[model samples]
Target chain A: MNDISTWDVVRNLLDGVLWTLGLSLTAFVLGGLTGLALLFARIASTAWLRKLAKAYIEVFQGTPLLMQLFIIFFGSSLIGLELSPWLAAALGLTLFTSAYLGEIWRGCVESVPKGQWEASASLALSHFEQMRYVILPQALKIAIAPTVGFSVQVVKGTAVTSIIGFVELTKTGSMLANATYQPFLVFGLVALGYFALCYPLSVFSRRLERSAHGTRAH
Target chain B: MTYAFDFASLLEYRDILLAGTLRTLALTAIGTFFGLALGVLGAASRAWQLAPWNRVFAVYVELIRNTPFLVQLFFIFFGLPSLGVSINEWQASILAMVINLGAYSTEIIRAGIEATPRGQIEAAESLAMTRRQIFLRVVLAPALRKVWPAICSQVVIVMLGSSVCSQIAAEELTFAANFIQSRNFRAFETYFVVTGMYFLLALAIRQLMLRAGDRLIGGRRT
Candidate 1:
């Protein structure tokens, strides 16, 4: 029965933006760590590790993120995990991000010349030492741009968490739209919030790509 | 872990699941067709730098790409109605999918277009071919051929993204899963089955697109 002003709407949505950023950051960091492990498994000498890692990546990549979130959120309670929306959202996004980052980084790692691996092997370096010093250092250069670019996706992905009642930006926008009867303004600002967050990353990613290509050419 | 998993209970609601799968496929079919067409036009405008339209599409592509599709869908489904433009859930879902895929494919196709060798265009000009003919014969096919795999991936992404349409009550596969679980109190089983269905759908769509890309573009060049 009470009226909410435009300022109040903006403020509420801004609060939601913080949650979105927090979720994105959490997912990116956790996902990056998990993806690093997955990458090692994928390229490991043992066949079973490689096969298992491949399966994990394929399952996550193949299913829709929304369904992943739903399964984690709703399915967990049935098995007695009692996951809160926050925990489910974070866990779901972490898995999704890890799958993608693992694949992307695997491509980057594989792109490193075969000579480097052989040279390290000839130098009597172990597999871990070779990856730590030669292969990963070389792969890191190519990986930076894409990894940053993926952060934008991670940010946009937080919107889907709203479906599981995480109260992030998109969810806040919807609630405000209902309360204020101003879906256009509310959603537009919500979108603008994302654009503000993502456009810079996209531009930076492109710039890095250009620079990477430029260096490779020389 | 006292919960008994009963997948057989879902067998009774197979019709709902079947209908939902059909609807999702229909959405992806229409979305992919129109989205790629719009992408071609947008890519052309930007690749050639066609004055005002180029600038228009540049902004359009960035806006759509940077924002989440769910917000875009909410804007169309929920926001537009407030501005006196009414559309149903199905229309909003399709429109959002098309617009989302269009923006992405525009970027993908433009990368292909920009990679066209300058000498090829000059050679076409020397043959007295019109600009239109040069773009069509000399540029478009090869550009498309080069980027067809990326386009296929993006299309599958758009298809997977369609699962979110259930938020607006579009009655897609996810919606069916939700409906079934709510009815039978089998949330885990329903989602587990539906997620597997989505995985199979993604694989099928990717395979279909690859084969189509081969027939449509790849075969011509060789």
Candidate 2:
């Protein structure tokens, strides 16, 4: 039996941080794309599309991410589709992130004044033209800060993927803690790794928020 | 491939599921209560502009806000025992949740508190009110009213977040889902039921918290 040194633990955990970053990036990109579509649906002219999008958001928002991960990981197998942890984690997170990001974006889009729509409509712009030329450009300004802010959440949310045996930072920390019998040092470093990833984004998000508010105030 | 879903098998484990749901509800209740209290104190202390307390609270909020809650739970559950401070899984889960939620609510409540109108506090000062009286009577209620919705949303987020506590084997709803799945080999069905329960729990908690807020903090003059 070989003893794991502190350096070995830290090195292994650092490797785990890479996976965490990868998963976060994957989820954020995929989720952002899906979220845009859902956002349009939520604010669509037709009543049914908006209602359907709202219901989708409600289900994802109302349930815990842990359960969603579980369903994706284990539930998929029951239906004859075997999924790796990576696939399950990515899928589950994408769904969860889409719900939230969609809602955040919808709020931002709606924050555009009703008069803007009226003005754009009077210009005889199509709905697509109205959104593309007038609405989304304005909404995008408000959305950027919160979107960056939500990236923090998407990062932290990756931690739950550890439950399904994804070898992300938290899971690696758990394994290292058990191996080294130094839960404090291992998990402390794990938290620090997360803080390293998340803190900067949080500060940047706040800065963006302040600047956004500053511009809005002006 | 023909796969039959057996939700009926899940009913056999209904008692465990019920117990887990109740435990989750209890954990959320206790954590929300203490978290709100801690938030109020942290907000007040931060608002006092007392140098060290403000710095200390800022650090606490930032650290907790940055890290994942699961690591925080592990640190408490696993790390504390190694340091000669022994605690059970339930205590650790609740403590971790309280600390996590407290940090969040501190920022939210502080925003509310800072938004207190300057003129109102000055009017209280003109009446020869003590600082504590002014904070309590003039500042806290309206600040609370202003931010009750945000606070309630945070509480719901914390409640949904509590699902992670099951990882430490605290016998929460998610734990029951795991248990029933292992028993019946109905992983999808078990989690599907559990997810539905959690959704209901979140909805119910949000409604109850909002009503409670209305009773406690609403109806006051803005």
Candidate 3:
């Protein structure tokens, strides 16, 4: 609908990239916090909370990310509610990210040896205190590698947000491709942009993994 | 806030929705079958280090791993037509899916293969087993037994990823939702129902896979 140069199209996409990053950051931070709460709920003393959290994780993890985005963005509007694309995408991504992040963290928590948990319990430490002081510190070490690895997934998962008409990087590329008759150029640039966003996390995940394995060996 | 709740439009499109779901399952099954075969070969190739072939195998994995699936899909759907291949969208979607599944499965199976201890191979060879016999008897089966759970998870991912093929106008679940949304302006409701359908489908798939996996693995720890 807008007559514009290739550069303008890309620049517009660059501006949209900020929103994409913004959405990812908000989702990561909020989802990370929510994920921690979920991790606790999943493994702590209360059996009921653990079951509820497990169900939440299964529902989110089992379903497709695209479907989750559709539900929050489209499902809400069906029931006499209006949600802005930004709000809907954020909500959807947040929930999806939380389940994954929660699981990732739980794996880290479990990686702390059974001996450590037993030691904590034998010290007359309250369960909360055991988690707060002894168990978490060790688990955090094991957790960092996978957490970083999961971040790469989180970045890639954000690409699905484009389907919501959110005007993010992929959406921009689609619109530009439609206009420019340059599907290759548009998507190539979009792919490169994604690689740029995701590659660092990938590298970091690998590095963390190598070191974590090294430490475990020691 | 004043929108009337309507199930009539969805009911009207029930046949279309059912057809879409069937197509979705067909696409997943085809993609999974081919992808697994390709992945196993790729993994075997990489594991045995077939010289330059191994490098080619590495390049294939790295390239597919780094790029987005949407880009890959378009390269098949839109780009292939330009290159004088007039394949239909469904064919193109499955073609792209096969490649994607192959790359991912290659990595997974390669991991499984490498994790098979060397002693097992030696032990099989000592039994006067030929290379083929050793690989089939000692390596592949046990490796698959070990990695099928992870492989199953990736298969689920590939299945979920099929919904994106709808962008190319393949008559899949997401495409059905898009149709209902555009036709009735029920963007929200259409997507909601479709999401529920996917959740249900995914559950059914997991249950089915779990049973098969249990039978395959059979009291062996995953």
Best by DockQ: 1
Candidate 3: regions farther than 4 A off: A1-13, A78-81, B1-9, B184-189, B213-219
Winner of 1 and 3 under DockQ: 1
Q: Please give the ranking of all candidate structures by DockQ, highest first, separated by commas.
A: 1, 2, 3
Calculate DockQ per candidate and list them.
0.89, 0.87, 0.48
Q: Could you tell me how far off, in angstroms, the CA of residue A109 lies in candidate 1 after the best superposition?
A: 0.6
Q: Cα RMSD to native, each candidate?
A: 1.3, 1.3, 2.7
DockQ of 1: 0.89
TM-score of chain B of each: 0.96, 0.96, 0.93
Model 1: how far residue A170 lies from native, Å: 0.8
Worst 10 residues of 3 chain B by lDDT: B213-222
Write candidate 3's Cα lDDT for B1-222 as tens digits. 467767667888998899999999999889988988999889999999988877888878766676668767876776667667798998988998899899989999999899999998888888899998888768887887788877878878888888888888998989998888889887766776787788788878867876786786454465
Please, what are the lDDT tens digits per residue for candidate 2 over residues A127-208? 9999999999999999999999899899999999999999999999999898888898888999999999999999999999
- Using alpha carbons, what is the TM-score of model 2? 0.98
Q: lDDT: which is higher, 1 or 2? A: 1
List the candidate 1 regions with Cα displacement exceeding 4 Å.
Answer: B220-222
Candidate 2, pairs of clashing residues: none
Candidates in order, TM-scores: namely: 0.98, 0.98, 0.91
